[model samples]
Target: MSTLLLSQDQVKELFTMKDIVEICEKTFQGFGEGTVINPTKVNLDLGETAAFPPYKGFMNAMPAYIGWTDIAGIKWAGGNLGERKRLGLPYVTSLIMLIDPKVGNFIAVMDGAFITNMRTGAQTAVALKYIFNNGSSEKKPIKLGLYGAGMQGHTQTLAISELFDIEEVRVYDVMKAAAEKYKKDMKDVVKGEIVVCDTPKEAAKGDAIVCVTQSKDKFLLDKWVKPGTVIFPMGSYQECDDAMLMNADKIIVDHIGQCLHRGALAELSEQGKITEDDIFGTIGELAAGKLSVGDYSDGKIVCIPIGTGAMDIAVASIAYKKAKEKGIGGTYSFV
Candidate 1:
């Protein structure tokens, strides 16, 4: 048996934004057409930590199988903000495994931290392409508001900068220093103006807003957002308030079924604020041109992503293929 091993750096060297974009486009097309088998994510809760006051969360392991391709895999990742802070590390730690569909044998193991960030960013970009009228003649460039300055925020900003002709980006975070640092780091890559905002309300004034903060309580308000703006909520669990969701003209998700069950949208449904019927459709449906964004004169459009595993696998599969073609990763045989 032969196995391929790829390190995080190796995987990074092999994959690019363009590659991830193509992978996401294909995955979204398949998902829209009902040609993929992506199961719901499994959540594992971690008990209370005495070290950090009132800090509790869960670990998520998502398994998926993609049709029209010979790839199957699972993304095993865990996050605990309190414990991570104690250890001086980020909240989430992730890894991915690619399995041979025929024998169900492990073909490769790689770091999923990069895969998760990149795929999530790409998914948001795909949604933006379908949600906004890019070709329309508008004088001012599209404005962007971003919440959080963490990995998700950084990567999503990079992806959005690559895909959209953004004019300005306003960022807000509880930690003012972190937000400033994020702006400094992103200055090299982002062409638009990066302004740090004191509050979510200030950031929400942009034409488009992206929320990636991990806030148990609500942070966004409906009154701050302008009509015709687009919102992308990346914080999975409880990120936005009922008012924001209720006021949205169209609610788009990566997968309505999964989002309705355990994601940010689920929390809203549990409170009886919104139901499955409230959602307009999935991002895939929009990408495939099957569902339209419809009239936007009423209010803004919101795209909530639950984070799909098929995207991670598709990206990993592409990375593995490139590694083989370019003679990147070392191969070994066992008897």
Candidate 2:
């Protein structure tokens, strides 16, 4: 048998954010219906070192199977934030291995960074589609507030723009240059106006707020969040305070177990400030038609997406297929 090998550039050509969003919808639906098997990711901590200090490094092993698609895969992903500044390397690096579930043989291997960011952003888009009742047809333009102007930040705007008519995007970062760069880079990417804020609070007043920062500290105060606003905290660490979850009318997570392990609510769960009961349900339930947001026009919702292996496999499988059809990837015999 030959295994398909796809580089990052090849993977990017195989799919778009629109494609990812659609697949994510189906993937989450399958997850909710118990048609998908996504194990909780196992994390390996890499303690702080002088070489990778301040950021601390870690690796994650994420494995999943999509029964409907008949494919299985695992993602070996890791990141070192401090190394990015020191060594001019990417903060996150990942590779995905697609397997034929029947024979348990590797079918393809591909770069996962693009897939990671796109799917992570697409997850939020999927959540908003079901959680928020408002649509672009309402003629009420969306004002998006963002904390952390990085890769995920860019993709979040891209994904949300496909669902809402964004009139403005207010972004805040500790680095003024980064926020300014985001505004300039996203000017044409998003039809909305991009504003760089001096403070996190300035960016929190919006129709929807998203946090994709690397800050280990809590920056999003509950007081700054307005009513009827939906918050998406996509980072691994806690960005918003406990009240953000405590006072929220609805709290939907990508995976309940993963959320407790390392995402937005991890710290809260560890401290006994919040429990599984506090969570409304997984976004999968909403996607699968098992639950609905139901007239939440006046409610505050927090959707925490910690990233999922099922999504990675779903997207990777499509990319592999597309590459095969287009004759775009290298093949190596594994005899």
Best by TM-score: 2
**CA deviation > 4 Å runs, candidate 1:** 48-57, 134-140, 331-335
lDDT of 1: 0.79
lDDT scores of the candidates, listed in order: 0.79, 0.86
Candidate 2: regions farther than 4 A off: 48-55, 134-140
The worst-scoring run of ten residues by lDDT in candidate 1 lies at 133-142
TM-score of every candidate: 0.91, 0.94
- Mind giving the per-residue lDDT tens digits that candidate 1 earns over 50-92? 3434556466788777765668898888677676779887777
Return the top candidate by lDDT: 2
lDDT of 2 by residue, 135-246 (tens): 2123345788999888888899888776767789999999989899889888986676888999888999887899998887888999888788999887778889878888
- Worst 10-residue stretch by lDDT in candidate 2? 133-142
Question: Could you tell me how far off, in angstroms, the CA of residue 19 lies in candidate 1 after the best superposition?
Answer: 1.9
TM-score of 1: 0.91
